[model samples]
Target chain A: MTKVSIHVTLKEGVLDPQGKAIENSLNTLGYDGVHDVRVGKLIEMFIDHDDVEAQVKVMCDKLLANPVIENFTYEIEEGVAQ
Target chain B: MTKVSIHVTLKEGVLDPQGKAIENSLNTLGYDGVHDVRVGKLIEMFIDHDDVEAQVKVMCDKLLANPVIENFTYEIEEGVAQ
Candidate 1:
């Protein structure tokens, strides 16, 4: 099996209200050093196939991420036991 | 500045409807080899503090993640330019 992990993050100059809310909450909780908090999605999956990278890219483009507003990067580990 | 990234994922045995939905979507989209799709959160932030790891741990425990159902891990890079 192949293990794939994808990180999907908002592109620069895009607004992230959820991240802003977390930053505010952190400051209110006295973690004042926290700043510019941005939140994204992490998708992990197992695939029993070859050409894992290309397949994962297609998955990200088709359903996992919005290419217009988000960017995605993935790491693939092969030969993992099922 | 310090750059910290936190990955919050649902603990084993926790129900993940979002992941199930994504898995179903991928199967429907003809990605048959894909399985065990899990969705999580990735939080990236900058902190101007010395004890970044400790501070981030507290943040995770306090507001960033629910200890009851989720587990979190973080990576910190020091001396990042603001």
Candidate 2:
């Protein structure tokens, strides 16, 4: 089986309330130099099916993500099944 | 500048606390057919510097993600600057 991983994040200039909350918490934790804290989402799946890339892309668009504010990418690692 | 998108997630059979929380929330949202819910993280950044791939990978390992629990993949989109 091959494992597919996807990353999704908002475009620049897009407002990220989740990220803002995390950023504020980080600042309170005394970690400085953290600018523009935009949050993103990650997804991983294992598929024995074919066309890993195409299938994963469709999954992302259909239910995995919101395209208006987010974008995603995926990679397949063959022989990664354990 | 080129933008790098990183996707991080736990390997299969690995327990995901965040994903479980989201799954419970999704169950409340009435989303069916959701069997395994593993939460992942996504990060997007623009780098004008050379060696974009290497730099992004280093960033992922050093600060962007926890490798012990998460594995990440990144894609470099050239000319993604707006």
Candidate 3:
């Protein structure tokens, strides 16, 4: 099986309330040097397919990520367990 | 600033309904070769602190990750933007 690691993050210029909140929280917790924070999702999937990259792109575009405001990047590793 | 990428994933044996649902969806969408899926979170933070590793550990322990069912790993890169 091929294991792919996908990271879905908000695109630049989009409003990120969750990330903003976390940044504030970190600063409040005495991490005074914190400049910013961005939170996103990481998806790892094991597939038995041959065209791993193509399949992953389809998965990300269809459901794993919101293309309107989010961008995704993935890496594929062969013969790995989930 | 220092940028950190943190990945928090569920530990083995913990239930992963979201991952399961995504796996089912992928199969239904004709990705029949998909074997399994695991969903997690990716957090990127930019900090001006010198001791980045220590600060990140505190952030994960206190707010960024759930220690009971999730495990976290982080990589710190110097002089990077958010």
* DockQ of each candidate, alpha-carbon based: 0.93, 0.24, 0.84
Candidate 3: tens digits of C-alpha lDDT, residues A1-82: 8888999999988988998998898888888788768889999878887788888898899989999999999998877854
Please tell me which predicted candidate would have the highest lDDT against the true structure: 1
True contacts kept of each: 0.90, 0.32, 0.89
Could you estimate the TM-score for every candidate? 0.98, 0.58, 0.94
Ranking by DockQ: 1, 3, 2
| Residue ranges of candidate 1 with Cα displaced over 4 Å | none
Instruction: Output the worst ten-in-a-row residue range by lDDT, candidate 2 chain A.
Output: A26-35
Better of 2 and 3 by TM-score: 3
Best by TM-score: 1
Model 2, CA-based lDDT: 0.65
Candidate achieving the largest DockQ: 1
Model 3 clash number: 0
Error of 3 at B7 (Å): 0.7
